[model samples]
Target chain A: MKTLETTLRSLRESGRKALVPYVVAGATPDWTHHVEAAVLGGADAVEIGIPFSDPMMDGVVIQEAGLRALERGTTFESICQELESLETEIPLVAMTYYNIFLHYGLRRTAGRLHDVGVSGAIVPDLSLEESDEWRAASGDSDIATIFLVAPSTSRTRMRTVAGLSQGFLYASARMAVTGAASDQGEGERVVSELRRVSDIPTYVGIGVSTPAQAHTTAVFSDGVIVGSALVKIILQGASPTDVESFVRSFRTALD
Target chain B: MDEINAMGQPDHRGHFGGFGGRFVPEALMPACVELEEAFRDAWSDEEFVALYHRTLREFAGRPTPVTPLPRLSQRLGLRIFAKREDLAHTGSHKINNVIGQTLLTQRMGKTRVIAETGAGQHGVATATAAARLGLGCTVFMGEVDTKRQELNVFRMELLGATVVPVTSGSKTLKDAVNEAMREWVTCVADTHYCLGSVMGPHPFPWMVREFQRVIGAEAAWQLKELGVDVPDAVVACVGGGSNAAGVFAGFAETAAQLYGVEAAGGAAVTSGSPGVLHGMRSLILQDEFGQVEEAHSISAGLDYPGIGPEHAHLADTGRATYVAVGDDEVIGAMRLLSESEGIIPALETAHAVAWMVREAGGRLPTGSTVLLNLSGRGDKDVAQVRAMLMEES
Candidate 1:
């Protein structure tokens, strides 16, 4: 399987920005359908959120989605088993809180994710200063570790995070949690600042909902990650076709 | 075990025997690092220590007197002294920790403070401290808590702090914490999360405990003056365990037995599984898959799914004995104390009183001396208690 770095590098070479759409695993029993739709909509990568009861980084929309997923008996083992059947070619990155890995045995969970076709992982709660154990566990499985750079991040810390992140640097468009509207100027400035510090492929997430916002964010970064917006659509009882069309619009805009 | 004790807690990476660590999101990392550094510097500074005590003495009322509950002690056949933390300015033990944290917030050059409150004592204390310290303050309370604790909500607003009503996820303390942390992520640059208890991440459990330790220190000196070298047992109610941890820290190495009383409806220490929640790995009410479970209690303050990590560590090491008291028992105990000693204890603190009522006669040795922490007054709980009493009648 190609690594996340290779895919982002390829997208850059092709003169196209990447589209990474996020959907919560087990949001419904057929949650895998959302991943298939995002991939079919021309997404270069996908982020599958493993539901946690207390997601401090998430807004109301994502929190509701996770609650629903948990009510449907979604477990990490169930998600991994379901991922093995996913036929998408794009790299799938698992986005979760650090406790999930700590509970599941980090090294063991990393190997399981690798076996099930997950190419990378993003633990928003695991800061760069506290990620040594996570990095070591995931490194053995050749699973790339993605780190986030926020507006509140210092320049020195930004350099450290950028240097350590294996796949790509996640640039949070705003200081707020996920699902709020992105400020175009702030989004552009954060991406520009990230670009100035490192040449690593940067994807701006958190409140990049609309095609216009995605387009504005993509102009300053290598890619854009849409999470709460897509999760909202899915939670609002949208069909798989609706999800595909929604993702396709962003793909077209990015193109 | 000896080597672990010699190394002395948290072991540099902030693990209280696999209970506490920095499990917050990446956005809060720099803020956490900054807060930890600022705490280390200010905590050791003589000026900071002197000022903190001076404020307590002058503004918040320190060295709260210990009252001997002779009637209740005679009934139970055991001698008891109540440390009167409920007599503090804000009517609870919460003010001590807030005074320290609000000062540290100023020291860190942050001008705003955010906190989550369950029973509203912490909210009232934070609002009071922020007003005194001349800083902006915001308090998040669950929608359910707001309805039950409406007077406290109004009190916080009247004290010049904004109270945000969170309507998510069971609408209780845990949800309030979730909302507060979400708000802190965005405003961490100039805002400090004035955590109400000895829980969450590294520096919090340690820092809050230190601020609260003065309670035990005061109690010990007062007890010694009364010619009591060491009480048979030192007891306090546990709700996220700030007061308990504070009081326990004083008697940790002493011969006094440490006892923590948990609400039967929310006995995380006695009936919970060890798992990670709210940035700490501690005993929590979680299912097999690690999803946090909602805890239930008539006392909103004790209605939480998780306890402080230090309490969990103490439980594991047998340094403390944890027990549970039911709602009915607490209500009866509250009435007994009020009728006998002219003290209406907060329902959270009444849990400890209830445990003593149930176990003092048979379980404890005759003539045993017990030091119980009266964590808070019952003024805020009068409306809720009245309703509960009406229901019982």
Candidate 2:
């Protein structure tokens, strides 16, 4: 599997803005198909969620998606098994809270993800200071560890997060939870600040749902991550066609 | 204590013997780290400790007398002294920790405070302390709890704190905690999350325990003054286990036994499996998939699915014994205490009383003195108890 940095760097060289889509791994019975659909729809990479019971960063939409996924018996182990069976060209980074990794044993989880051809992890709850163990584990397994920087982040801390982050710096578009509307100007400023601090590729996530929002975010950062909007589609049991169409729209917008 | 011991517990990362760690989102980590530093700095500082005691003594009415339950003790044929925490201002032991945290909030230069409440005791305490300290306060309550404890909602509002009725998952204390943590993340710059319980990520479990240790310290000292040695057993009800942990801290290094009574329907320590919930790795009621399950109890305070990591550590090492008591037993204990000693304990605290009553002759020695931490007054629960009795009739 391609590393996240390799994927983003290639996209950067092509002068093509990255279009990363997100889908919860076991949120629906046909969850894997949604990823394939996004891939078919021209996604550079995908963020797959390992559903957690208490998703503090997520808003109602993603939380409901998590509930549905968990009810369908989605677990880290199960999701890993399914992802292992998949054959995707681009990196599929796992997004989840720290408890899942902590509970599963950090080294074991990272090793399992690596074995499954997973490229990286975005543990939103694990900050730089608390990420030493996870980072070391990821390092041993060659799985990139991504860290998030919010609009509220201090410049010094932003530099610290950028230094610790491996694959890319995830700049949260706004202060609110996922699914909230992203303020374009505020988000662009955060992305610009992130670019000034880090040489790593930056990706804006949280609240970049619509084609316009995703395009606007891509204009500022290396790319944009669309989660809750895609989650809503899967929650409604939409066809892979619907998922592809959604991603294709973003792809068209970015082009 | 040296910085080594301080840093050791909930160590640099907040683990209490494989429990308690920072399990919050990255957005909240900086704040959690800052809070931990401030807590450590304040804990060792003589001035902070002195100010905390002064606030407790002069403002919140600490050094509450330890009253012997002569009538009930004689009837049960076991000596029992009730640590009258209910007599403290705000009518519960909740005020102690709230005061300490509010002071810490000010010390951190944060001018606003937020807290989660189950039964509204913590909400009232947080609101009361915030009002007294001239800090903005917002207390999140589960929508269901607002209906169950409407008076507390009013009490918080009267104290100038906004009570947000959370309409989220479970519609109870757990949801309130979720919402409070979310809000704290958005407003971490100038607000302190005055966590009502000793649960949650690092610093919270350790910080809350330090704030509440005064309960045991005073009780131990008071018992000594009364010419009574350590009680055979120190009993306190455990919800998030603040009172139990506090009282246990006093008797932790002693030969005295510690008994923690949890509401039977929500007995996390006794019935739960080891899992992470509410930012701490403690014993939690969860499914095999590690998804937290909803806990049930007539006493809202005890309706939490998780206990403090310290309590889990204490139970694991056999330093303390935890038992679950039914709602009927809590009601019976409440009535028994009210009739026998004219002290109506809160439904939450009644669980401890019920435990003592059930094990009076069985586990405890016939003449052994058992110190019960009367963690709160029952005035808020009179209506609930009356309704239950009415339903029974």
Model 2 backbone overlap count: 4
Stretches of model 1 off by over 4 angstroms after superposition: A185-199, B1-9, B361-363
lDDT of 1 by residue, A1-255 (tens): 237788778878899999999999999777899899999998999999999988888999999999899888899999999999999888999999877887788999999999999989998878665688889999999899999988878788788889899888899877788985846636677777777779888999988999989887788889999999999989989888999999999999998
List-wise, what DockQ does each model earn? 0.65, 0.47
Give a tens-digit lDDT track for model 1, residues B1-393: 111231135656577886788878777877888888898799889999999999999989998998888999998889999999999999999999999999999999999999999979999999999999999999999999999888999999999999999988878899999999999988898999999999998889988988998898889889999889889999899989999988887778688889999998789999997777887778998777777888889788899999999899889988898999888788889999999899999999999999998888666677999999999998888888998789878
Candidate 2 collision pairs:
A125-B25, A125-B26, B10-B14, B10-B15
The DockQ-derived docking category for candidate 1 is: medium
Q: Point out where model 2 deviates above 4 Å.
A: A77-87, A102-117, A129-142, A152-160, A185-197, A233-238, B1-9
What lDDT tens digits, residue by residue, belong to model 2 across residues B1-393?
432231236667787786777777767777888999999899899999999999999998889889999999997889999999999999989999999999999999999999999989999999999999999999999999999889899999999999999887778899899889888877889999999888998889888888888898899989999878888999999999998888888887778889999998899988998876778778988776667788899888899999999889888878889999998788889999999999999999999999888988888878998999999999998988888899999
All models, RMSD in angstroms: 2.7, 2.8
lDDT per model vs. reference:
0.88, 0.86
Question: Which 10 residues in a row give candidate 1 chain B its minimum summed lDDT?
Answer: B1-10
